[model samples]
Target: MTKNILISGASVAGPALAYWLHRYGFTPTVVERAPGLRGGGFAVDFRGDVHLRVLREMGILDEVRRRQTNMGNQVVVDADGGQLAKLPASFMSGDVEIERDELSRLLHERTRDHTEYLFGDSIASMTEDADGVRVCFEHGEPRTFDLVLGADGLHSNVRALAFGPESRFIRFLGYYVAGFEMPNFLGLDHTGLMYNVPGLGVNVGSAGGKTDGGFVFPSEELDYDRRDLDAQKQLVARRCAGAGWEVPRLLEAMWAAPEMYFDSISQVRMPSFQRGRVALVGDAGYGATLGGLGTGTAMVGAYVLAGELAVAHGDHRVAFPRYEERMRGYAEGCQKLAEGAGPFLAPPTRFKIWQRNQMYKALSWRRLAGVFDKMTTKAARNITLPDYRPAPRSAVPRESA
Candidate 1:
């Protein structure tokens, strides 16, 4: 039986997968390159029945709600910080919004006792045989596992080693995004402000007591080292050199800020998420960088993958294909919504920006508000979760790790 599993990434997907895998009488080891749990990511949210149901089943829904970010609707503004349109909270915050760090911590807390987490290490190579897969780590001893899963992000190390280079599967949507936190000079109270011009968009909002600064600008693909943090920041500064409103301040803070996030707003298009004994979940399989409902999707995918494995009696041949088949359509629906995120958030032309602004303004009307709220969540609610009851641990076959 395929009882031992290795999951790459300690973020939302990895830990969440570990939790479900343990509950299903499987042993899961999570490997993270970061020294420990990295924090301070933007707020992620869950919407619809599927997302909430999975969280509830995992017994974290109420805790998630307790720590939810009760942020209100965002205000779209002019170059001078004048309000243009109001973006409803439903479109931005979803049903239950929480910081990515909080969600990661919660998942880790639930699985830390049962899951083996290897920090400050990474997978260097994976060699699969008929019996099992031999895995080598960058800073640890070699080991073998029955199955390996890449729950890593868009630039997954496992995917590059097992599948192909990222270029083969990543479809760059014509834009790049960057975010960091700084002092809250704007004094925003549980609200966000958006400023845009042509193809460049900037947002500086309050998160706790700091300015949650973010940027999205249209750009063709460029060559850069993903490991070079200073170089990435410089690139963003050069691209977003001159912008109106709080952009200059945000850029300046970005240089001094301790943690910054920069990546292409791209989507992963994989023909299949499984190959031999290796499989992928979340962003590693089908992901949209920003505004993709990725967090909620990752939780649901973890539940489905682990549940399918339990139902299949720890057989990869049955579970892997079943998991992919059940999740493909739902994943595609979420990714489809992300295809236009770049253009919608940072429109190419003034006319396009005006069109987007007008659309948001229209949604603010009386009857349209309710309809718009539902429209934003339709794709998220388009899935039927399987009712999986894992066999008792004593009834399942066990393998030594």
Candidate 2:
């Protein structure tokens, strides 16, 4: 039986998978490259019945709700700082929304006691045989596990080792994004302000004296060192040069910001998520970096994978195919929602930006509220999940729920 499972990356998917695997009587080890849990990312929301069901099954729904960001509407503004249109909370925040870091911390807490976590280390290499998968770590000694999963996200190290180089799978969506946190000079509360020019957009959401900041700009895939902080700030500064309505102030804050996140808006597509006894979950298999229901999808994907393993009695040949069959279509639907995000955030021309603002302005009409709500939420409700009920006395559930 594949009782010992190794999961790479300690973010949402890894800890979450560990939680279910332990409940199903499988021992799970998680290895993360970060020294500890990361904090301060843009907000992530859970929408629809499927997302709520998974969160409820994990028994963390109440806690997640308690920590919700409660983010309000986003106001579009002109260069002179005049409000143009308002984007509703329903479109921005789902039924429940929380900061990404808050969700990560909560998931980690739930699984830390029973799951083995190897922080400050990462998978260096892997080799599979008929019995199990042998794994080596960058900082720790090599070991073998019954199965291995690449929960490690978009540019997954595990995917590199097992699948192929990243170029084959990663598709840049004609835009680059940068997010950071800074002092809330605007003194905003629960709301945010957005200002846009042709090919560029800046959004700042604040609560009290802190802000969650973001910039989306149209660009061809540009070459840059992913690890360089100052260079990233400079690139953003250059793209947004001579901009108006708090742009200079945000740029100043970006330079002084302690933590910054920058990336090309991209998606990962794969033919299959499983190869041999090794598999993938969350962003490693299917992901859109932003605007997609990525956070919710990852959590649900983790639950499905772990539950299927239990159902198949750790026989990967039986479990892996079932996992892919259930998730592929659902995953593709979510990806479709993300394809337009870049253009929506930063339109290619002045007329397009104005047209977008006007279109959303019409969405605010009371009569159209229902239509707006359904548009934002429908793609996320594309699947029906099996009710996986793990029994306390059984090592693996004898019958699937």
Candidate 3:
């Protein structure tokens, strides 16, 4: 029977899953809360051979490489903007770095013809029985599907509805980050500047004539309204008050920027990725807020989830566990990468900040640089992907309306 699958969130994981599921002869319908594809966010990279091979399978490797930021070295600067040290591109860019929105758009375009996309809507509730899951959307009619997947990211509405409250699965890593677009006020080109002070820091990078910037600060769990953009901006402004370097100017730009992204640096660790007919892929399943190779991991997990389902002939009882087993170790390893990022980016004390700066400078040495390269490569290459062929046309099952 052809299983009908509904995937939430039209970002990286959702569309990738749709592509694979369609190739495997399943029907996939994706619902996204956003009005349309999003644009302009931080850059994300694909590392090692594993990630490269998957992109090749999707036939977008060359396209992605063509869109590479080709960013140069990043300079760490002091309060007066004096260069403290330089970190090479290889240390940060990995194999290739593309803007988040660009990658998402490319994936959507690749899968659009084969997938049913419902934008400007969200999954509001779900009820599961022996054969399928009945889902209610906030802005559309309720429907039932053979399986439901949550590719909806860290604060996934699907996960919340299907599994439980986010508190049970989310772990705060003691920091908050905000990113926004600003004019190329500094006139930087294809490079980045970073400034740090005790418990706060800002990184601004120039690309394609525009600047992408962020503020990171150490904090305990904060009590704030998640839906209040104005309040979020005010909180960021207050936390960054009196910061030196270009921070004041950056704050000014932040205040006027059209959109902003703010969230606690956190990870989602679930005991199992699926329950009944509903499953999760990407950050919705195993995710770290930042520094975790989440974008790459999401692509990988989406590939595996669809492939496993196809291989198991659309039986969630068999496919979901296999998918989880294949991904668990790799996902955990990726999540661990985020553990040090909070302290490294926004150390709680001035002495720690100085210590981190000195360590980063040492990474310039060939031997020291090789250590990070090997570590990241190993993390990305941990799982050997299976060669999953498309099922025969006659093998596809019929779905019940």
Candidate 4:
């Protein structure tokens, strides 16, 4: 029997899981709260051989490479925009970097014909029994499926509904981040400029004719409406009110930006990724915000989850446990990478900012920097991916092919 699977969130993990599930003789349906595929967000990278292998299996490696950001060295700038130091591209871009929207579009294109997509809707409630899970959507009719997976990201609605409230699983790392689009007024070309002050930092970079601006600041847990865009903007403005460098202009552009992304820098550490017939994947399961190499891990998790299900013949009781066991260590290592990112990027005091700048200068020496690179490479390649043969080609529909 072909098990029916419902995946929430049409971002990286959802569509990737859909592609693999369909290939492995399962019926997969994806529901996204967005009206359509999202566009224009931060750039994400894939590092080491493990990440490349999954993209290769999906047959989108060459396409992703073609669209790679190709970002060059990043310039650390002072208050007067003077270059304090230059950081190598390898330290920032990794092996391959692509815009988040482009990655989403490619994954969606790959699986659109094979999977059913329900946009402009979200899961409101869920009930599970011995046979399957009954799910009700905020904008659509309730339905039941053999299994339900949450690939819905850090603040996953599915995780909240199925497991418990987000507070049970989230660990805040003491920072918040916001990013939005702005005109390439600085005329930056495949490069970026970063300015930092005590407890606050901003980076503005351009790629493919537009600039991406980001703000990161140290903060305790904040109280704000997650859905109110205007309120979020005001908070950002207030937090960044007296920042120097090009921040004033960036703030103006932020207010005018068509859309913005705002969230706390945190990691999700669940005791187990599966409960009953429902399971979580990607950031919804084990994710570290910002610098955590999450995109690659999410893709890897999707591949492993689907492969295990196929290996277990679509039995969640067997497959979910196996998946979690195999992924736990790797996910924890990836989550650990986020631990120092906030303090490193936005130091709490001016002396600490100076200390970090001096450290970046020391990294200019190849031997000193190679150590950090080796650490990242080790974390990225920690898991040995199991080779699961593709499902029989006969199971694939002609149109999907």
Candidate 5:
């Protein structure tokens, strides 16, 4: 019998999971809340060796490299936009930074041809039976699937339905982030300029990568509503109200932008990423925000989940437990990085900011640079992928519904 899997969210993890699930002879249907593909957000990176190897196996590494932003330099500026320090772009963005939407588009395009996609719809209610799960959609007919996976981001609807409230599993890193599109007013070329004021917020502007730019507002807790867009916007505006150059301008631009994203920067933590027939992949399960290992971990999770399912021959009892066992330690390591990085990202005091700058300056020493690199790479290399060969193409499932 062909196994039917319902995947929620059409972003990075959903489509990637769809790709491999389809390849492994399972039927996968993706339902996204957004009416269509969402575009325009900050760039995301894939670091370390594990994620690179997964992309190579998926036959998308060359394509992903071609789409990289190739940002030139990163400049730390003062209130007046005067450069305080200029460093090579790779230092902050990563060895390869690509626009987040472009990567989503690539993953979507790759999976759309083979998978079933239901946009502008979401699961209204879901109940699991001895045989399978019966899911009712907010906009579509009810159906039953063998399993459901939430590849949705930090604020996941599927998670809310299955696990308890998001607050129960999310650890807010005391920050609110907003991203939107606007004309490159700062005139940044293939470079980005970031200005930081102690206790205030950080505002960044870049143009070489995408037409849109955004800002980050770090706070003390995730006190705001995750769904209330207006409230989220107000929070960011209030935090950076009296802030330095380009911040006011960016806030004004955010007000008029058609598609804006605002959310608390939080990492998802669960004693177990799996619950019965429901499992979570990517940010929905363990996200460390935009700059952390969210994207890379999501990619790695997709590959591992699919491979494990294939190995178990569609037995959730075996596959799901094995999946969590294999991926949990690595997820914990990535979450730890987010905890250590939160303070540096949102320095609460001027002394902490100075200390951060001093640490950056010390990296000029080759030994210090190597130390940081190894530290980062060690976290990045946490996942140990299995050597499950692909099932024969003849096993691919045919459409039944």
Candidate 6:
């Protein structure tokens, strides 16, 4: 039986789910608000063992490996912009460091032919019955589907429609973050430079494709609305007002830059990842930040969801429950790590920041590796996948060929 699957958001998790769903003989339609593929941003990585295995099974490891950013080491500077210390890139962005948007585009390209991508559209309402789900779109005509998945983001439309309001699930991590592209005026090479004002702020710029520099300002609590980009920009501008070392210049460029991304640096914690036929796969369900295992969890969640659905014969009740059960532990662990990173990235106090920096310098690579190994091993062990055999050759339809 062919099942019609409606996937919201076309970034990482949506396209990934579509890829596996298509391979499992289900038809997937992805709806994205972005008119086209979004390009450029900080690098994201696939750490640990299981996530790498997912990439390998998906047959895109080679492609992703080839396009990795490989940004090398970073040089940290003090408040006066004097060199403090340097660390390897692997520590920051993990083993594979590809530009975040690049990975999204590559994953989208892989499912382009197999999935129906509806750009510049969003779901307005979803009403589900025993038969199927009735979906009303912001642009397209109303339709029905066997199931709907929300990979939209932290403020997921599907989650808002299906679950309660976002405030119920989203936990503020007491920080605000913004990232945008700028000119390579710093004339940096593949190396990255970071200037830390200790607890006040931290600005990082790296020479890479499509990304010139990024500014990260830690805040106690943010008041600006997330949907208002203009206000968000003003918030960032106000926070860094009269700052030193090319900050004013960067702000000027930021005012003109077409693409600006901002968020509250929070995590989405849910008692359950799914309710009824509505399921959330990625950031919508659990997101802490780039530092958290959210990316890895999303990749692994996509794999498990699709695999479970395939094994359960498209029964969301069985598949969705199993998917959540397999991923909840890993998601919680990632969220915890991301929470720690917020303080570690920019400690709350100057004394604490100095102590953390000293610790980072003192820690040996072997010790760091041991800590990472424990994290990865624990996360990887949370899942137990079924050996679902492939369908018989005779079951393959000629149209699918």
**Candidate 5 residue-pair clash tally:** 0
- Report the Cα lDDT for candidate 4: 0.88
lDDT of 6 by residue, 97-181 (tens): 6777888988998999989999999999999998888999999999999899999988899999999899898988876666777
Candidate 6: 10-residue stretch with minimal lDDT: 392-401
Q: Per-residue error at 99 for model 6, in Å?
A: 0.8
Q: Per-residue error at 293 for model 1, in Å?
A: 0.9
Q: Against the true structure, candidate 6 has what lDDT?
A: 0.77
lDDT of 4 by residue, 253-363 (tens): 999997888999999989889999999999999989888889999999998899888877787887899889878999888888879888988888889988888888887
**Inter-residue clash pairs, candidate 3:** 1-397, 1-398, 2-397, 2-398
Local distance difference test, candidate 5: 0.79
Per-residue lDDT tens digits for candidate 1, residues 166-196, read 9999999889998887787788988999888
The list of candidate 5 runs beyond 4 A from truth reads: 205-212, 220-228, 364-367, 391-401
Clash pairs (backbone) in predicted model 2: none
Query: Please, what is the TM-score per model?
Result: 0.95, 0.96, 0.96, 0.96, 0.92, 0.91
Q: Tens digits of per-residue lDDT for model 2 on 262-329?
A: 88899999988999988888988998988889999999899889988888878889889989998999
Give the higher-TM-score candidate: 4 or 6: 4
lDDT of 2 at 184: 85
lDDT of 5 by residue, 89-119 (tens): 5466665667778888999999998899999
lDDT of 3: 0.88
Residue 24 lDDT (model 1): 82
User: Of the pair 2 and 5, which is ahead by lDDT?
Assistant: 2
Error of 2 at 105 (Å): 0.6
| Candidate 6, residue 303: lDDT | 84
Candidate 2 wrong stretches, greater than 4 Å: 208-210, 391-401
